[model samples]
Target: MKGASSEGRFVIDLPDSDAALALAGVGNQTLHSIEALTGASLVIRGLELVVAGLPTQLEKAVGVLELIRPLWQEGQIISSVDLQAAFKAFDKGYKEDHASLSDHILVRSKRGIHLRPKTIRQKAYIKAMETHDLTFGIGPAGTGKTFLAAVLAVRMLMERKVERLVLTRPAVEAGERLGFLPGDLQQKVDPYLRPLYDSFHTLLGMEKTNALLEKGVIEVAPLAYMRGRTLENSFVILDEAQNTTSAQMKMFLTRLGERSRMVVTGDITQIDLPGGVLSGLVEACDVLEKTDGIAISRLTAEDVVRHSIVQKVVDAYARKDS
Candidate 1:
């Protein structure tokens, strides 16, 4: 390793070529990403990275690189998600050493792909899930609300914390009628539940997921199916909850039986309820805002971890709505 320093610039030498390559990404794409994110001029020569910028920008850039170093050492494939998360953490003065922010492993896919929260709000959401029997994750699209809930529910089932995983959502369509559709109740609701199935498939693989569904270890159904039963010893997730009416929401919440956990996630702004009908999610948040054993995590556009343009799009719509 080598070192060089000046008034406003520094050089970090990476002795291991593989680690350096991992950090720089293929074709220097990661380096360019870091440069763009931190507004720092970064040049890679051999295994050394020379960073030059305003003193504060350079310091933050180096902080991000240092934060990611351990992930690379542990053979974790760094992605743009990692970069964005690191940048957001530093920019917001969030304590970067939190385990959920970097090293917490939520679940491992059947193929060994590790999934974890990619933002601070996501970390908070996961922590809430662990601590509270009921948690509400309200956020915009791409904030990982439904996805994380599904992952945690699956993990709880595998760990024996829960006997079953029940996933449900309202079958409301976005200004579309379901009366003209054919087939039985399952067929009518399967389309609305496809997102939950996709999450299950990603984490458990298609064959295993189908097997679990067949055995009833995993159940995906419309919210209407929850009417008359107490969900006991189960990890239940209500997705697209904003589409639920007040009565429906109350019914769902009261269905939580002993030794059960419920995670309700929805985007309030995207509610598809009939005109003048208040969303159950909105009403529940208002009523439960201060209740014990209930956690509410509000994620904003800044927590949107999809493509970069998604944050911009959310911001644009938010501005327009305002």
Candidate 2:
């Protein structure tokens, strides 16, 4: 298929140079991915897009392009997730579901940066967060569980939907010994919450993030500090809930006050608790599986939007565990 297994070519005209480049991606890498995945050679010449190879392959590749046309037509950047979603539609014959994946923007920053769900499960997760007062997002790393929650929280704060945003996590080490580290309590705890802060910094620049923090509009603290307080009119996120004890999870969930929203996100497979301790995230999911006014969005390796290798790594580990 790489060297022309069949004598055929398909040509289609794009609307403009922007759409052509958007479809081809930077340095034509998107075309390379499409070609490698579909066994069709794809190239762009000005506004004319060419697909060459076996007739069936050409048709399939063109079908994928049509499915993802919603993105490129809007000058949106497409990634491996988009390609995978397209291939999934091609195989399952669910093109309409795949096409709606790019239909909505979750949030946009002041600098014109748009953040949206990269997969179907993510879209559902966002919707769950919007509808439910308390939601649990269980998944592996790189699934955007906590990141999406942070983006929505930021949007709520900016739009005055919420009075403040509170980001908290259990102060648990992940397979690393931190007891001997030389720092105060806050200094020692900063590293654990750094990832959550990184997401805010990306959505809002460092200057704006610091300003919000200084104004107390955004609060980052450990879960222990959340005890004995009602978080009213706030968007609260508890990261790494898998490390929380049953009592701790119950305490955190009870802290939800009127007009407050809470999201608990964690990866149960990566729990680093003591041998006999149960993960609060696991326990909560089991207890609340049938509860009303709450949602549990479980993302899998397919929902991972990081580099493709990360998905492979998750799948490999999952296979070994299974």
Candidate 3:
């Protein structure tokens, strides 16, 4: 391997053209992503990569490349998702071996999508889900709150830990009124529940999801329908709960029965409840913070795993609000 001794810079010579191509990705997108994430200037000349920046950033960039190089060398394809996880882990002061971060697979979807925690908070959230009967995932969007909850719920159902899966969400609109919606009650509320449906579709293919829905093994409905039912032996997830009123939240929580697990996910900052209406999620947390068998996992912009700009957008709005 070629090496450079320039101050605040390092050069790594790839072992072969295939390894270099894998590291660089198609059109050098992978190299560009690393540069953007670590604030390093990565330039490729033949099979050689030159990383130049501040000492710390250069070090981080080189370290990330070194951690991922083995995967590529072993003929494993590294995607942007993998790189993002590495970047987040490094940024969050992860001291463990980086390979461990990439190796911790949470779930493998039917379509072969491997889901894992992209940040430290996410790792803790997954642990909380496993250890607690009720988990409150309070966070900003794109933090994998609902997605991970759905993944766990599907796994539980497949393993027969629960006989069924229940997914619900508040129907409160951000600003629009639902009165103008078309079709019957189910149709009116289906739009609000589409996100949960999308999650299940991702984990279990559309065909199997539809079959389960038909068999009543999977139920996707709005929070209003949960008023008078006792959920037993099921994995239930309440998404977008910030819009629920105090009474609604209490009712939903009370429905949890024996052999059941519930995950409540919401972004409090995006609450759409009417004036003077207290959000059930916020109030429930205040009341249940000390309760046994319940756990809360709070995720922040640092836990966001969407497009990198999403994290910046969350930070920008947070700064404005503060």
Candidate 4:
């Protein structure tokens, strides 16, 4: 049996080349995750590993290493069962005390909106819709900000909470390169709003979604066309709010009419605005945070509902920012 120690080089002598390869694959996954999660360094030499970190981190790494050892046995397939077990055990031990979004939105219907969030952020967002005529969700990406807002807008339209559903985004490109596109205004702007199309297809299915669009019950338009009209008694969502300049944002907000609500969602980290232009979403958040009828909820990487590794990467980037 290989000895478990406080700090040292460890060698797990293997029987054959296949076993060696399997062990190395598992080790690489574990080491990469550990380094990403805890800023540890792992140096691997064949079957031997030189792990350098604080004692507790090294102990945790060793524990993970030992857990994957049996799967590396000759003729054993390092199967999904082993990986699931290891990840599940680690997840169980590391209960995410950070608030999660498993509460407010539920996956009631089968096809549309697969995720159900039951956390404070989601409830707060929903409540903001109920109370305020306009709310902004500014946070990191993959935090269910845009998706949940879209679902809520759909529900409002379906339940007659609002008269219509209006979805739009800024048609800004990486380099102001709209003229180079292969189509006219609507077609050119369509690509920027692809995410909205995807969400709509998932929620309403293709035929009904098309019918609703034709009837104007569901409108997908570019921000430029939004300048002349006011949206009333409707649920309006401005996805990718970071791309909207402060002036554009204010114009959109002022276009809100009676019995209407606007849910603006964006990741400040991903702002594609011109170098000096401040995002309307971020500026609105700063100005309206303490206002009576407005709500702003910020989500972190911890609120990411995607793969666990995504959370690790987001956290690593956030640390780098700090």
- lDDT top scorer: 2
Q: Cα deviation of 84 in candidate 3 (Å)?
A: 4.4
TM-scores for candidates 1 onward, in order: 0.89, 0.91, 0.85, 0.67
Cα-based lDDT at residue 87, candidate 3 = 65
Better of 2 and 3 by TM-score: 2
Query: Which segments of candidate 3 are over 4 A away from where they belong?
Result: 1-22, 38-58, 66-85, 97-99, 174-179
Write the residue-wise lDDT of candidate 4 on 1-322 in tens digits: 4654556434455667766666555646645664554344666566555666776666555555555554455423343333433443444563131123223343344352234443345556666766777788877766778878877888877788898989999877734587788778778788888889778778778888889999999899898889979899999999999989989988998889888889899998988777898888888888888998888877776566556576678899989998
Better of 1 and 3 by TM-score: 1
lDDT scores for all predictions? 0.86, 0.87, 0.84, 0.70
Q: Is candidate 1 or candidate 2 better by lDDT?
A: 2
Residue-level lDDT of model 3, residues 225-304, one tens digit each, is 99899999999999998998998999999999999999999999998888888999999999999999899999999788
lDDT of 2 by residue, 1-322 (tens): 1222346887877888778888988888989989988999888888888898888788789888888887787676778877876887787787777678676687776556467777778989999999999999999999999999999898888789899999999877733455666687666778888988898888998999989989999999888789999999999999999999999999999999989999999999999889999999999999999999999999999888888899999999999999
Q: Quick one: ranking by lDDT, best first? A: 2, 1, 3, 4
233-306: candidate 1 lDDT, tens digit per residue: 99999999999999999999999999999999999999888899999999999999999999999999988877
Top TM-score hit: 2
For residue 184, model 3's alpha carbon misses the true position, in angstroms, by: 1.7
Alpha-carbon runs more than 4 Å astray in model 4: 1-107, 110-115, 174-176
